[model samples]
Target: MSTFDDLDAFVATRRQAGLALSPDGARLVTTVAELAPDGTKPVTSLWEVDPTGEAPARRLTRSAAGESAAAFAPDGDLLFTSRRPDPTVEAGDDEPAALWVLPRHGGEARQILAPGDGITSFEVARDAGHVVVTTTVPVGPAPEPPEGTQDTDEAPDAAAALRAARKKAGVSARLHDRFPVRFWDHDLGPGRPQIRVHDQLAADRLTEPVAVVDPAGPTERVRESAISPDGTRLAVAVDVRDPGGASGATGDRGDPAAVRVRLELRPTGGGETEVVADEAGADHEMPVVTPDGRWLLWIREEHAAPGRAPAQSLQARELAGGGTRTVVEAGRWAIRSVTGAADPDVVLVVADEQGHAPVFRVSVADGSVTRLTASGAYGDVVASPEGGAVYAMRATMDAPPVPVRLDPHTADQEPAVLRGATEIDDVPGTLTEVHATAEDGTPLRAWLALPAGASERSPAPLLLWVHGGPYMSWNAWSWRWCPWLMVAQGYAVLLPDPRLSTGYGRGFTDPATGAWGGLPYTDLMTVTDAALERPDLDASRTAAMGGSFGGYMANWIAGHTDRFDAIVTHASIWHLDGFVGTTDGSYHWVRQWGDPITDRDRYDEHSPHRFAAAITTPMLVIHGDKDYRVPIGEGLRLWYDLQRHGVESQFLYFPDENHWVLKPGDAKLWYRTVFAFLAHHVLGEKWERPALV
Candidate 1:
């Protein structure tokens, strides 16, 4: 075995994902996921990063169940939600997560509050320490009466208990009247989401809770809510059903079935609700109030029609009961992770641009933008109240998410690494950026990583890796699609950002959804042609790979061109019409592809299945049965097509996996089989059977 061929090393890699900062900015916290003691499940734990890059990183919480959703309380306390067993109280096997607090002064972390169900998300007021939490409560019919049983004082409680028992006994079934019967990966109905606002008088106690946005029943759910900076009001995003009334996410009978999200404001202490900001054909979400509570900022995503590109704008409103709307950042560069930096008039926005996701400072006064930290994809910026220090989690194609400190106002400054518990082993490759131009003369950019010692004399074979999302940019490190593994075996992988990719301004991306088959496919080939132009890349021995939307593109590329020696498509789509109906969220595709029957022309023209008979290159298809987004049927059909046509193809099936092959064993096999397939096709070597089937 090669020195880097051990699967254990791949499984042992610690993953760091999210970041948070203390109110004073003295401490930076990040969530790190690693294998548990038994190496069975990945446990998420909070790690304290030295914001100033001085102190050694420390693990803040350690428990068997793990902790997540870290947030800072007003009085310098750290609050997180956990399902860890509390020794002070009896716990059940199916324990609902409860709120726990770790005092800033340092002491034992203890449970502060518990919800009837469990807390999904929460926001805390900076001044009053008020908390707003969202939870779900399934609505069930009252238990059937016991054959004309008489009403008693405990009848309601008895029936509720019986309903719970029935659910536990697998007798409960759900019937939905809503259009969105299913969401991403799960069914949506049978329960309604509630946003509750309440004040925590002291540790381990609460005064009372007020239903800021109460629901009539299970259908009217509340979402995207935040506690005001002063704890005096609440801002939330609620679904505004289409006036046409008969549509939603079910995509039933080819109806529009679209719903838009709007912003609403109500008193935190429970009072009148007002429409804070609502734009027609737009959804307003991710509301955040300024530290002074003078301005409220949120994201407004304008729904795009077929043959058009969707747009996102940073919308703002005056919270002083006045009426004025402002576009802080207008649909440019895919602004993300928007937060009020140390300067209230400016916000720290992480945007995808070129080949990186950099932090940008956007001025609220003039709409001018300035780039902050130089190179890397930044996430969740946190700044000191004094406007002096800023910390962000930076990632790149080569490095995983790592906390770093940078000047908030610096136009270009190197980020000082804030040491954390998670770190990567030495990368065995060289990373560089390349550029290309599409058939329409539009420029494209991608990150290309080549193995060590790869050069003109010993050119490395290429792997054209298409990113999923067809909208998301390839700016950050992805464990699922890590090129280092392929590079470790002497291959160069190209990560390109096609037209539908973000980080570019609206002009480059907004129109991309409508032209996916045209520009996205063209731009990908353009980048591939550019990469092959390099002296160190082998053009004839290249291959293409992708998952999800990338898988769709791979399928398309297979039918359109045999430029690559082979292709590997995972969690892919084979039939557009079938995908629109069977996918967990059918409404999403209709927005971009239109109704299949009503708009059959577009589907027929763009769907890859129509041209599958033209595929000549060998292919490898990978899929998970539990993948609801791209159903297993897509993979099954593609496999059958390849076999029926007598094409040299292999199918790697995963029954217990999802959209992603997440298990340690499964992940290892994924890399092993992919490399083996590439070795046989790209290098003209004998196919090596993987350790597992």
Candidate 2:
């Protein structure tokens, strides 16, 4: 079989993530997930890439469990977390992840910190030897921090000991004092996620850890935390919900599950942390301090609701306690991420622009946003400490993400691509930007890919591939949802940013804020219709497919119209009323959707199930049992709905998967089944099921 046609080669494609620059700006590190020699599972390991684009990338660590969350310590040591056991120092091969440090000069990686509860993630202080670690511990009384050993596999904490005891007793019951008892796929009861501060005592061991910011109302999970360069101040995002104790029976305004997450700035020494940035109906997260420690910059996200439009703006405040001000509100585009630069006058930012995720340098002095990269998706941007160049993972429709270094002033002028990473089969297609006007006269756009062989003589089949995260723009290189895959099957894929999509200014999204079924759905159809006008696209043979929010739209399309030959929905929301409560966080959707009990109009009007009886086209319903965001109940209910309605449908269920199909074999089967289904419906070919499935 050809390389592109082989499932193993497709799965072996480069999977790179998490880029970090050394303090001296000489060396760089990134984690890549590659198939092991045994070809059983994907393993993540640290790779040292040349920041100057002068040399080939080299592997830094090797292990079955692999390494992750790497950061350069102040002393030039590479700090990372791994589950691999220490060779000289006895440790469990499949044990919980522990912090390991590799010397700057080339030596063996030594186990530094191994807490009993185990560390999920860790961040090294830029100037200080302190380290901030996030871990899950038993919710019982506090115990003395036992001295952890570098050369031993012993866990020195009471929490870990109690957990073992509970398992031995076969006690699985968990008492919940909060609204969300479960997250994406796992129950949150056995242990609660907490942030603890620890110091690197020496080269081999770490000091005792201490819980600093445990709130009183409800248990909070620290999603992301950043420490100041000097290690004096810590900015953290604590995800918590308001467990209502108001006057009403069901609590304030009949919504007991309302939640709000805030970013707090506090001294690293564990004192009262001030709420640096908090909006009534918004979320503040990923607070990063400037290199000079003068400002704490954070991304503010306004929730979209019935009358209000969603917005993402970069806001900054004086580190000495001052009111926050909008830094780049004029841009209108949602800022993806912001990284502080050595130059205090400017900070590097990444945001969606039209159909591309480009790098932007926002000047703090006048709040001017400057486009750095011309046109492509860029993320994991880090400014050099020496103030020379900016480094990021650049990806486009034509290529996957590759580490690149760009001139600080004119990044797009001559961005140097760093090599030594695995390459993939060059996508055999032509990528073009296309636009259309919505019903309300709002201009919408999408990135369309047409197969190289497409022609008017034998036009390729059209596939309206809707992107997930209805709010997120389809800009980056996505191995999971590459349009090239379908293009390889002689199909043209239309990736539209219908509505509520970031980029293209605020006016493009505000109109369809909470009204999902209104303009956004039409915008999608509008773009799809416009793309079909191309001579190389055969609109008569077309299909529509999406996942998550896109899946919701696919379900909506199945119910509203029968324009396409078939519809494929994965991890979709079938029943709106049951979904809002059963989802990972109800409060997030409740603000926009309102309570299903009180404000039933939007839920009833926007829900796909309300119009399921009108579906006439064949559909393939795909979902994973482990998906807690849109639980298995949704797919099960959706399948039964179609069966009862006597609609032509097929079900693709994954028992061991989550919202995303991550395994190599599973993903191969997914693409195979999807193509086979499309072939039967769109191409009018005999249905030939995937060999393995």
Candidate 3:
């Protein structure tokens, strides 16, 4: 069987991410993740693809520790980061990742910038080759430098030594005087991110690093950044807390204040900082400086409120103190990333639009927008310095991400696929579109994947797979919530983009902002019913499954309807009131759902936990202990509620995993368990527990 037909093979399939274009646009490189020799974890390696699509793609760098964040310096040298041990120093397992450079003329890769704690990410200036890097530093004052050099700034290695001393003393405590003490899956404690500049970058070494944007409090950090083509100015998006706290009474929940991301422009060589964009209730990020250094491009998103979804648009400002203009109007689409185009007046903008994340060329001069690609989701875009071909990674439901070259001048043009590090020769199913109108006359659509042998005479069992983010779409390929795996097992998977999903304009997403179980839930059901009418699907033996927000809907559907034979929810919310207070981003959710204490109407009406007694369908609940976003408490409460109500159910728990089961072995088990559950309840097969449970 092929990879899609076997869970083991699927886990071993090589996955690719990150794309880098050489300065002259002669070479393209990306990092590919593959299972390690021990078969315990995945390691990444850099691979180079020919820009002209003439020669086959080949490996560029390899190491057990792996390499990532690849970028090309102006001198043609390739730069990357890896945790590989430095040959010149004695390495330990705790050694952090360091920056390395591969010579342009083809030679051995050398470690150039190996700070004590190591670098997190770095960007290379297009023209000057200067490097700007972000790294973590201890929150406390730096230990004093050796007495002789008191006049000079603290030694570069002082902070590293202090960190080591703390480790030696077994001090692993983190004290936070802010709202969010944690992030997605990890604690945001003892150290914060700091930006540093390196003016001298050599083939074999780098000059001393200078602190640029140092955070004064734990609440401050850089959101996004970009360096100008001339390497003289650095644009950064910084997150800072507002002096006034939340709009309503915070009630001593450790809530500091509302946070806003501001755009700032600072000189590279230590000078005054200029606040370019600082709106009161909005965030500005994803900075991209035009090739000629004439215009600065970034995304602005207003804060979301009850019944009012966050509106996003692209902003372009003249670097010479001229006024800023909205290049892409609000409610048009949710912009993802912006890249400088070959033409100085034009910039490439990628946004979700009608079930696809396509590239759009926006004229920075006139605020005009033109679609460039016809279909497929695109990301990591780069344009040739001489205004030639534009390169990006594109993916569709039927295919994984692959490098593609696009034309900057053409509108809705087909992208030319370039040879990538890995390829899938076959997919186990066929993909087609499913459309339906909501009860309110709003349009709804979905992508249906049918098994290879599905037909009217031999229909495939159905699985309605709702996407997460209630705010995101099922447009691109996702290795995590893949549908091909289900289709390979003789099932038709329905991938729906309901009202809450992006790409359909703000009108589609607005109604779902505060009313989670209202329009979005009904839209999902409407699309599923439309798909069930197909002759190639067996509607009677259907199951429903989803993760995150989709999981919340699965719970809602279980309480409201019993059309499906079984339901599977992963990393979901059970109670809106409890979820808002405990989630990492509590303030953000509070704005959307209202205060659970004072404004309790929405919580009482929409929370799925309140309807647990009404559910009759068999359920398989899944959650990870490390999932701070959804929290494992939701899963435990759901399991207990199911048992108390005498509902047939099973709990799949991951103590070491997060919101997503990312480990190879755990991900394989996740699929096996879900398939087994569906096979028994939906296919009328005897229940058989997964092995190694």
Candidate 4:
């Protein structure tokens, strides 16, 4: 059996993700994560892959603190962010992640920039070596304020000093006047996100940082940004709260106060910023400057309403004062990213189509779209500076992400995979698509992973694995919600893309917008029934598992049906009314289901907790206290409801983890516990608790 069957071995397997191509397209850099010695954390290191696929990949960097966000400088030097201690500077425990550069000619990697609180993300100019970095700066009033006034005019240049003073004085409170006081796992704090520019960077030291996009408060944040090829201008996507609501009302029904990501153009050197796109009810994000620096391209998505789902389109504007044009129409496919091509006339766009996220070339003059890659999902796309080839990290359900080279002109091309650090010899199962029809005659499809060697006489138990981001699809490989582990245990894992899933056009998602337990649930069931029709799958023995929105579906399944022998829900929302008000993005949820107070019928009908008394299946509830997206209260309340109703259930809680179990040790335990619970309920084995639980 492969490591996928063993929790410890699976956790130890080296994981490869992210890709960066050199300016000449001769070298490819990828980040490989390997379990640390303590087996608690996964440490990442940089590796170089030959773009030609002739040379075996070689390790480029190794450090205890790890390195990531790799990008290439205009001069071919490799730049990455790391928390590794600098040799020249005195080491400190509070050292943040700093920018480091590895010379292309050779020699040691030198620390270039180390600022307080470190950098989160950065971009390098293609024609110029200018660097733009995204970091956090301290905000809010000092410890003791006079009267009722605050230090609103605090200088951003003295942010480090202010932060140090606050820390030294043991004042850790953040007074927030925004709609959202917290995010996914952490509170919106004493510091907010800001972008800085480094016009001059050296090997020995970093230049004094110049704040370019300093937001007003914790509410506003830089969502995405890109630097021009000439390094003269910067395109940034900043998220800000809507003044009133989308319809200019006081956030009543049909109108909700939402935080939208708006596009802005600013000079690399300090100057007035220009608002490029700030339409109401829509978000403009993922700005990418064309290679020739003539056009700026980005994705514009409208906010979802009651019966309507969000619509996205690829939009472009001429940098030198021209009207914006729609390069691609809305509802064609869910656009993931846009990469500048060597020829600015044609850009490479990666989008979710059917079951795969393939690369497509779109004409800038016209909106003609052409598929480039045949299969698999791609990320970190880098076009060749000279124009023949494109490089990206490609991954399928059966394979982890690997560096691959693509032919820009070829359609449906099977890209040649470049040898990298992570490699898989064999998988525990085989992936096949299962198709069926919903009760309404709608076509439904799912990816089913069947374990090796299972006949009609000896069928494998089935596990229905629903994905989160009801808006997302099961098109790419996911480290957190992998199905291979369950497949390795002689169980068939069925990954379904239901009504709310992307890649199936816009109409498919509209049916499940405010109706969580309606079409999406039926679509899942329809696909699950199709998978069970196979002779190798045992329909009599089945289980359901999901996290986040998928977890909400799992809870819904538990109450609505008894088809499954066991259910596992992680970070699930039990009560709709409770969740919408408590979630990090309440405004977004309100847009979908409307006001829980005014729209009581919808909440009462769709809420999973309302039907909790009907659940008869054994369930394992898992939650992390730091998860503000779904919140731990939902899990605790669900556990209480299940126990009070005399339903067979167990709660697995993590105080340190967030929505996902990220730590290697914690992830191992999560799988072990799931495996044990399923073995007992679905396979009719004795109840055995996981060790260290």
Candidate 5:
């Protein structure tokens, strides 16, 4: 651990093993970014590797500008969205993201659409003829011009006259002003784009698309859409509210109202949609139709009471008969993903149970499931087309991700190291499971990373890392860069999945339900106290850190306790009252907080801002300026308040980053800043002061 290198080499080595293999298992696409010579901004590129070894790996798209959401068409052609360097539109205006297609073999890339169309996402049809593009269209007529349009004294100016005429005709003056704009806005907005079957083969095709599913009404908020294997049905997962009203509730756990998904049958010939399967209350996900088109398999998250794990049930519906049956019951844990195997009667399901996400096969007939892979590392498992072999991505904390092939028939589950061949060799430290007792004496699971030279006599500085989601968990596996970097610098790391973390029964995560600042915060205190009890940890020099919900905890901890010498909070919510008003999902937060306007005392009392004056620990706040979730304004308010209260605080803002720092250079810089802050405050190391701006 003491021999760890700089952040650049570390990230590069880590990324080597992070490439995603295509479904065909022939091509690999991964994001790569290089630091500009001046080290200001990153120049990003998406590279491809041919697993067949027939051609050398090549860079498909290169630009100083950032790009993401890259994927491959069914034919292995590259399709990605990119923001062009030169914008033809005015600043602060929407510069439409253009979709580009590049041949796998390599050739000139072609831009499919121009700017101003507001194309968000496009998926090629199974036949590869036409792509179903999602864009926003005006809902209603735009605002009209000034009242008095025709004036003889005005001399009928051409531009003004044209504008006046258009306004009189009910035309919108600005693009965004047009109503009923429907685009593929992911995870945001009142309405999302529905999956429309488009025909590329048609010669007289206009951009106008026939709506396969109407998302205009209150019954739908399409989160994601997937087409059937035979392309005959569309599965849409939406969080539907009440008709003509909002689904209001207390708590961020989404609307307490029932959740349902509709499996609509789409005939090749245009016709009305037929509902194949419909279920209510449970949160449904990963709706995949079997290859034979007889059954549709999906993962359903069954809602739990205030203190229980959301039960994950695997279910399948007979497409033709319109009857549904459970393949797996609502277990203590949740399922991740499911896919149709070559065996039409069986489906592959991935679930996280007891801190590990494993793959299993479930029979469509009797609902019996067989575990395929038991390793709980955070990785992906894919079933082969033949259903005999399974390919997986295995990751550990210290090691990069590797591809593992499993043959259930042979009972072989060995993994082949795919990436980071030269890196992560002889990684120091061992992973150990530790448990802490919550307020009610319930056991909370956690992972502890011992320093390379850890011993009772030479206790190492402890870095307590809290996970986000208040619902997410910290599992064993490849070491993350931040914690590993700290460990390499001679600090021990303790990651606790306190109450409210997933994987455990819903009861564990329910502690944070309506008691955001109550039981959950107590759970953190319990974990931290347990960490301090370890003889291998230096309790006097402890530091705490987390992001998102975890970030909120870090801020709360700093304000409440003087136990930690330093703290780092990222994308954290400092004030629940402000968060409910400023965040993109303010409604969700309001629901979580039990009505911000009505329950002002509950919101304010739970917020870290209320306790800011009690903070004695030097803190570092890292946030993304463009983050809509727990916006940068939240961080700014915290920093300004902390400064006003005479607490030593530092704030770092990544201008172009969103909720998560995706760019390589920014990530490296972020790690560097965190390391510097921790080293100076916790380890008493000399470091340059961070540039606050």
Candidate 6:
């Protein structure tokens, strides 16, 4: 078949796989994001399809810049995060990101907050009277040292200088400028944002707004805060650096240099503080309180789990007794978030195991784990108040994500497909489950998507799509739509749940311990080799791609091997040496790399940038300008190094994007660039290259 025909066929295959049902299980939301006339951009939108076997879906949110995080408010109103127009603010500031409230049936959306600044998250309070939002507020300036103090002066002078500096800097005096003060409260009205009842700190108190909980040292400011369901207590996730460490050089891994997480609780009316849990070396995140306010559920990672690695287990603690218990023991795969179900006794957990995230239910009393859904990987599960049904997005290796519903009690766990992806047409393809033996002979599970109309004798080009969480797993369902787009282009996609991936238990994911590059890389290579042995995959035209930790792997693979024709690394860490000093999570990186100061050689050897000269394949580096996780500077460093070494390289930088592109239009553009790059290098297609320099 001609390349264009192959592309068309691939798109058709993806179309079939892109079908997704909506949260309520009554409508379908298609994957509509596709490359616009500008081959480097995609078209993303929210479409509604009737699941009652009716006509095609109707488009819901149609905009050049798409919408995300759509949910039904307590009163059945639709609340979604969008970057629509905000005439109140002038252009050139951050894009207007506000929570838009609309009717479930659909209509014009009213912007709740005047757009212009960044609104990281919003939740409709149980009463629906107010909306809880977490946002970034600018701090004025750094504090000056005490008037009479000098660096070489007496001890009293030094203390005075520090206090003066702290006073002038406000709460964020010591942190990097990018680390702004994060304020959380209720949206009392259209124009006013008030601090929540539980979050109010008495004025003039020495405690500041909130406490920082990083491992390296204390954050001069508060980073994140969440409220309990009863609205009586607030759980604040603080990132405090260790104060006893060396100042300039990267902190040691075991030395407790990174931000250590602590769970602190205070009454809604403002009372004395209580420390619920604190691990000297580990970080606790995504804290959620039970409906009865009896237990607190959160994800915690032992400081021992290296950079960007998954947590050891999900833990729960009783507020009264102060005892902790393991809720879910799938190690290495991080639990993203947990929500109290309609039934107060059961809680729904959304976790990524081996890159494949799914929802599971656990009994608060007995601690029994029940698999609520089937093999398809899913995410962002919104449980009904009744606890009988769950709303989530499901995807597989070859399918675009479809909204689905899971009924936990019955055998009818198969997700009812809600809508088909509208952007790309689906091509015919066969999805298969395979297991490859790792270098240590451990079986690694993977999902393989092959081009349709292929036989044992016919092999198509392969695209190895790795997941970001080195701790996550590749599930059976459709969670990402990008892989389907490539599959539609006649490329066989292989998603492996490698060692250190969740779902396989702690032993498998523990490979990340003290060895970041060794076992995980071996597992990936083993899986790739096994896929090549399949009759339907073309071994000669293989490509590699991933984001975050996956991006790190892509860079690592590109530099370590020449087996793949092309590579794309998104929001990935390149230079471990630079990362030690630059990124916000440098201390965490050091811990993962086993104390870079003590293991400097190992850190340098594992870093992708260290071996940049060996990357001969055409590479595409994609990163968001404001990405704080794997900062954009890392990508730039790799892009410049590749160019300097006379390698074919291109960098696509999204100006208003973060670690992951959230805007619909930005997401579409990102996927378009990815496919176009892959098509050009992997399929030898005639595609235009956007100027990167």
**Best candidate (score: TM-score):** 3
Candidate 2 lDDT, 324-378, residue by residue in tens = 8888774387778888888886888888887788888888778977678887889
What TM-score, to 2 decimals, does candidate 3 have? 0.96
Which portions of model 5 show Cα errors greater than 4 Å?
1-4, 11-135, 138-194, 199-221, 243-263, 276-282, 302-312, 376-380, 408-412, 419-428, 439-441, 476-481, 597-605, 691-693
Checking candidate 1 for backbone clashes, the offending pairs are 248-257, 309-510, 352-503
Per-residue CA lDDT of model 6 for 241-263, tens digit only, reads 64333222343443444456676
Q: Using Cα atoms with residue i matched to residue i, what is each candidate's TM-score against the true structure?
A: 0.94, 0.94, 0.96, 0.95, 0.79, 0.72
Candidate 6 overall lDDT versus native: 0.62
User: How well does candidate 5 score on lDDT at residue 108?
Assistant: 64
lDDT of each: 0.80, 0.81, 0.86, 0.86, 0.64, 0.62
Candidate 4 differs from the real structure by a C-alpha RMSD in angstroms, to one decimal, of: 3.3
Q: Give the per-residue lDDT of model 3 (tens digit) for 265-304.
A: 9887777889999876688888888888888888888878
Report lDDT (Cα) of residue 86, candidate 5.
Answer: 38
Error of 4 at 423 (Å): 2.6
The list of candidate 1 runs beyond 4 A from truth reads 1-5, 144-163, 201-203, 216-218, 243-256
**Steric collisions counted per model:** 3, 0, 0, 0, 24, 73
lDDT, residue 152, candidate 6: 54
Q: Where in model 6 is the C-alpha error above 4 Å?
A: 1-119, 127-131, 141-230, 243-257, 292-294, 305-310, 317-322, 330-333, 353-356, 419-424, 476-481, 565-572, 609-628, 636-693
Quality of model 5 by C-alpha lDDT:
0.64
Q: Residue by residue across 1-693, what tens digits does model 5's lDDT show? A: 233556666555433223444546566665555555566555556766444334444666765455555656666676666765333334434345666666667786555554344556655433333455555432333344457766657455443355446646785434432122221122332223455555442332324444455564644554555555445556666555421111334445544333344444555346666654455434666667675667777777654333344567777787665677887877655666776666778876766565666667778899766776656553455455545555555665555555555664432144443432223444557667677777687887777888779888999998988887666666545333346776777788888877677777766665566467777778777877887888888888989998988899898888788988899999998987887666665543443456665566777778889898899899999888878777778889998999999999888888888778867677777877888899999988897764542
lDDT minimum window of 10 residues, candidate 5: 177-186
lDDT of 4 at 304: 82
